[model samples]
Target: MTEDQVLDEFRAAEALLEGHFILSSGLRSPRYLQCARVLMDPRRAARLTDALAATLPAELKIDAVVSPAMGGVIAGHEMGRSLGVPAMFLERPTGTFELRRGFRLEPGTRVLMMEDVVTTGLSSREAMKAIAAAGGTVVAAAALVDRSNGKAEFDVPFYPLIRLDVPSYAADALPPELAAIPAVKPGSRAIA
Candidate 1:
């Protein structure tokens, strides 16, 4: 799907939120993409993931798909379905990503790490690091929304359905406009 189309879906689903919100990455933004809401409809989810899967190069073989849990589970599962691969999730059992609950990869297994939204790409990079530590190769990373605005970097190639340049601010350096508004933590992860 085109960026505009994806954005339209977000709007139609009421997933594109506007408020003084704290992201999972600990940054504050006036806008947020609540992908769980967007991906709630199976048909819309399938269509988006299918389009996301189509972006992968034909030569790249994805052995398995792994995603960071809670936020990414459903979206990654749908993407895995489109790619016809096993889908698994990484949990933070000890405050960091891990292949817990018997979910794993064989040595040299090609993995496609996915997420619902990527702000600073921290979660994706953490999951990739864990996957690498467990003997898997993260071939690439994909996400439903990239709120990083094209600035976040990852160890693997990053592919996002929509590249949204949302403005964010650090707590100590909030913009005057954003500072005046009350901040709400709407993301799944809690700030430290």
Candidate 2:
């Protein structure tokens, strides 16, 4: 899908939120993409993931899809369906990402690390590490939205359905406009 079309889906789903928001990485932003809302509809989720899968290089071979729990679960599952591969997720019940609930990957199994939105690439990196620990090789990474403005980087090939240049700031350094609004955390991860 074209970038505009991709954004249209978000707009249609009302997932493109505006206001003071705290990202999973603890950064503050005036806007946030609530991917959970976008993916809540099964048909929309499938459409998004299918378009995402189509963007992958034809030469890329993926054996499975692994994503961090909570945000990535639905998108990852849909991605797996799009690619015709097994889908699994990593959980952080104890502050560390790990494969649980009988999820396992054979040694050297090619994996596509997936997420709903990537802001700092921290969760994606953590999820990739957990996939490695589980004997999966993360061949590439993909996300529905990348609001990092090209700042976040990954070792593997990275593909995002849309790249947004949304500005984010530290709590103490928030812009005056954003600082004035109450900040609400809408992500799955909590910051201490």
lDDT of 1 at 187: 74
For model 1, the superposed segments whose C-alpha errors exceed 4 Å read none
RMSD of each: 1.1, 0.7
Best by lDDT: 2
Model 2 off-target regions past 4 Å? none
Assess each prediction's global lDDT (C-alpha) against the native: 0.89, 0.94
Query: How do the residues 9-89 of candidate 2 rate in per-residue lDDT, one tens digit apiece?
Result: 999999999999988888899999999999999999999999999999877799999999999999999999999999999
Model 1 Cα displacement at 156 (Å)? 1.8
Measured against the true structure, the TM-scores of the candidates, in listed sequence, are 0.96, 0.98
Instruction: Please state the error at residue 63 of candidate 2 in Å.
Output: 0.2
Please write out the lDDT profile of model 1 over residues 34-80, one tens digit for every residue. 88899999999998999999999866699988999989999889989
Estimate the lDDT of model 2: 0.94
